[model samples]
Target: MAEARETLEEPILTGNGGPTDLAAMEPDLLDVEPDQTVASGRRRRSFQFGWWLACGWLILVVGAALLAPILPLWEPGTPDYTNVAGGLSASHPLGGDAIGRDNLSRLIYGARASLLVGLSAVVLGAVIGGLLGIIAGYVGGKVERVLLTLTDATLAFPGLVLLIAAVAVFGASMTVIIVGLAVLSIPTFIRLARATTLVIVQREFVTAARAYGARPMRVMLREVVPNVVLPVAAYGFIMVGVFIVAEGSLSFLGLGIPPPTPSWGSMIAAGRTELLTHPQISLIPAAVMFVTVLSINYVGERTRKRFEVKDSNL
Candidate 1:
């Protein structure tokens, strides 16, 4: 009798596999548990904190880089032989490098190189690529074919090898690095803007503007670009972090800004041999790079999600 009662209490499975009409069969199952609801809320709150933290770090790094010249820090290149490989102290807050140069100072100055390359490359790539992409997408025909063929060809090559070759051939000054990275970035933004423009071109507003006798240039600038820029810009934000890493990598490989100029990557390279004896030398700049990249990516992702939500709502 007890076994029969227990069997009858079990909810019947539907042909589709789930419990049949869960609400009718067991109303309690449809209701969310309190713990789950609270846990979800906590996760959302933690994400909010993380987003703000990421934004804060970016702001701090940018501000520090911009004001580095005026700040009363030791010159990045000045070395103290007596304090070689010293740990943290009043004079060297973060400590000294293998050569006794101020690690903190080098780290700050290095931000300039990283930021300069990252920002300039992305902006250049976006402007050039965005224009070509808009023209190709809005004026589809032979123009689209030619442009896309070039972009696809560029994309077909191995990116890192191409970058290395370009840097090697052109010489690895900051300008060469910036331009090389910009060229590398162009194909991506071209495809992104092209896809976005294609979507915007079909919209009712674009059609209405066209019907109102707007010139092609005006239509592209006023109608399509405004809609297309948001997503491209969002993607570009993420690309900034990537370009920073690229710049760092180039520096590490001796293809970036030369030594005595102080770059985060070069600092790491300089301190690499002493990693076991003076881990802080390499580790400090590495930590800064890690934080900087992580923060930029985190903020960019949040911005992308926000734009996506807005697009979905529209």
Candidate 2:
């Protein structure tokens, strides 16, 4: 007992334990709770400025997206033939689309499509894939074989081709697009969850749960899922951006929502016809997509590194 107590009291060390590294890796640490140690103060000084910039941009775009409908925003699809391919003006801040819809309105409403599709697809895929992966990793035997085979099969096809084919078959409705994206995404989640679960299942807590004769479902849900979910969720944040880009691509190819929907991709497609004449029409929406995707990646990368440190400590 003396040895055990002494071991508990010993300072825990990690490879990247320096305050500067911790602060850069997890600036939110300061935001969440106060730590008064000298090391923590040093960490606070070396905080992640880049992450804050990215997060701030994300919050701005998301806020715009969420509040778009409630605000007295201009109508996106209403055509102003006179303003077709118009440059930035007092009335049309970003200018008009091919048919004269307000550029700002289209971009604002387009956010709903891209973000909505991304979030819905990721959640749908994660729920199903995460559950199947946990079962396969914990149970083993025939279940593992079946699950792995299914995941692998989905992964075999080229992602773009698969999406196009799905949309072609199912039609280019928003629901179909979401379903198609979710189908493609499930394999990735399955593999990620399976790998994380495989590592966690061998840990002592899991072994103890089994030894105590806990029901398999109880052990899998209570012990395994909680431990494995953090990384998966971080990955999900990153995947949301990928899904957004993919949806945009489908729309650009005319395989997503039909014209007049104000999708970012469709906006680009419409503007391309007048690219040499009024470049801002296409450029504005493209910029928004680029910034949004970049922000999501930054948030995802930081989250991934933070959790990796946590898992290492455990």
Candidate 3:
């Protein structure tokens, strides 16, 4: 008993043997709360920047759509019969096309067609390519080998070449354009989805979900797909510009959107004949196309950065 008491009573090493030394022994004596606050503040700033970029693009797109129909802008069929009077005037803000149709009006209406083709192509491509890619990635062995081989074969051909070939065979209608663009775009989505699936399927959460008797579809749709969709969505936005340009190119080649219907591509094609004489006809539509495509690309790039930052935070 004496020995145990002696051991217990032995002086504990306290700094300077002072009661204040107890304060020095406290865990995290250096304050970390400020550092934590700094980190949180940075996170909030990043989130705000990301949201602003995303929402800005969304609002722009929506505004364009809403303004397209309501704004008088221009009359579709009425050509500026008086060719002598050109340039931006009060009556003709963007001037008139070669045939005297209001350039501004046609441009506004053309947005409808351009946006439609872009959105439709994206939806079709994503659905078809994403499904095939997911299946190929998840079901390995012969299935994977077959699907990947097919994807490789499809991707080998140049997109523009394929589009040209399809336009030649099918003729240039909206449906044909959409189909051609979607088909040409599929291989890219397939590869993207497959790659994402390959990584996601191996994650511990997937295994945990599986262990809990979650069905394959549930695991894929609820767990795997949601995580992978952000990249796909970003890619879709990028693809919208590609589709718009492709449609325009086809129209410029005299095989797109049909005559009478004012497509941006058709407008550009019309202006090509008088490119030197009445440059504004072609220049105006080209400018619109340039701005639209540029804005879309910028938005896509910003979206990709935002997602990358978000993933890093996670």
Candidate 4:
């Protein structure tokens, strides 16, 4: 009797082996038992708390960027001739770089650019690659062969080196940098989306939609895209964290955005010269990057786990 109730709730199966009349069924699909409802609410609260903790670093960096100019702090690019070697104090809490620019100000400003590049690259990669992956997986055969080959070739190159070379070729602007990383990031998203879609396309729900004579495009969009998007979004957070550190590294190497445009990497590179004398300049940015990356990874993993629903054919 319980199995019959479960089957009725899901409506994925019918005694006649035909697609169920979903229009007549209630949209809620499954009814929530009292115990199950309470457990779900508890889980939701736990997830919200985890997100709140994750957003803490995100909020801090964005707030720091927005409030930077208004703060009593010295401008990032302007040199403070009197405070080169001065350790942390009321005026300069993070101390001064070799050029005597305020460390706190530069760190805040660098974050604005670093995060912008990271997030922009992730969105670009996810959109372009996710679309192509969906096409490849749904259409399969010749189309899949051609697109996968191109991605594979791009994947074969040494990523960071290719990025630097591409930057070197394109003149190292923010737009060029984003393109470089997005190109590298596409292959990963392509593989993930394609793998997920292959499984989804074979599901009974997908077959039933096709049996109902729904156009291929409509079925793919209405069915496949929704199911695959959650996992892709979960993975995007990790990509953002990665691209952030990469941008910082490129800046450190002097191939990042040109001077006077504060970046964590360039700041760290500038302080390397004075490391023996004053290590605080580089350490502050490093600490911020470390904490941000760790937080992003933890939150991303948790989100992925929370969304790991086994495909239901009930």
TM-score of each: 0.85, 0.86, 0.80, 0.84
Candidate 2, lDDT over the whole model: 0.83
Output the lDDT of residue 239, model 1.
90
**What's the best-to-worst order under TM-score?**
2, 1, 4, 3
Question: What is the Cα-based lDDT of residue 276 in candidate 1?
Answer: 90
Distance (Å) between predicted and true CA of 110, model 4? 0.6
Q: Which of candidates 1 and 4 reaches a greater lDDT? A: 1
Q: Candidate 4: where are CA atoms >4 Å away? A: 1-51, 66-72, 309-314
For candidate 4, write residues 261-293 as lDDT tens digits. 888778878888878878887788888888888
Cα shift from native, residue 188, model 4 (Å): 0.9
Q: In model 1, what lDDT does residue 71 have?
A: 91
lDDT of every predicted structure (CA atoms): 0.86, 0.83, 0.79, 0.83
How well is each residue in 1-314 modelled by candidate 3, as lDDT tens digits? 33433453334435566554444434333332233433467777876776676567556654765587677666677766883326787888888877677877787778778888988999899889888888778777898899889889988988778877777888768898898889888888989988988988999999999999999989988888887787888898899988889889888988788878788898899888888888988988888888778778877877787677656544
Where in model 1 is the C-alpha error above 4 Å? 1-47
For candidate 2, lDDT tens digit of each residue in 1-314?
Answer: 33443453224324555444443435433333312321355565544676888899989888988999887778787878877887788888888887788899899899888899999999999988888888889889999999999899989989899878887787889998888899999998989999999999999999899899999889988999998788889989999999889888888898987766778888887788888878888899999999999999988988798778556544
> Which pairs clash (backbone N, Cα, C closer than 3 Å) in model 3?
79-100, 79-101, 80-100
1-314, model 1: which lDDT tens digit per residue? Answer: 33443464455455676647655556444432333433367777887899989989999889999999999898899998866999999988998988888888888899998899899999999999988998889999999999999999999988789878987788778888888889988989999999999999989999899899999899999999998898889888889989988888888788888778988889888888998989989889989999999999998888898678557645
Q: Per-residue lDDT for 119 in model 3? A: 85
- After TM-score superposition, the amount by which residue 69's alpha carbon in candidate 2 deviates from its true location, in angstroms, is 1.7
Which candidate leads the pack in lDDT?
1
**TM-score attained by model 3:** 0.80
Clashes of each: 0, 0, 3, 0
TM-score preference between candidates 1 and 2, better one? 2
TM-score: the better of candidates 1 and 3:
1
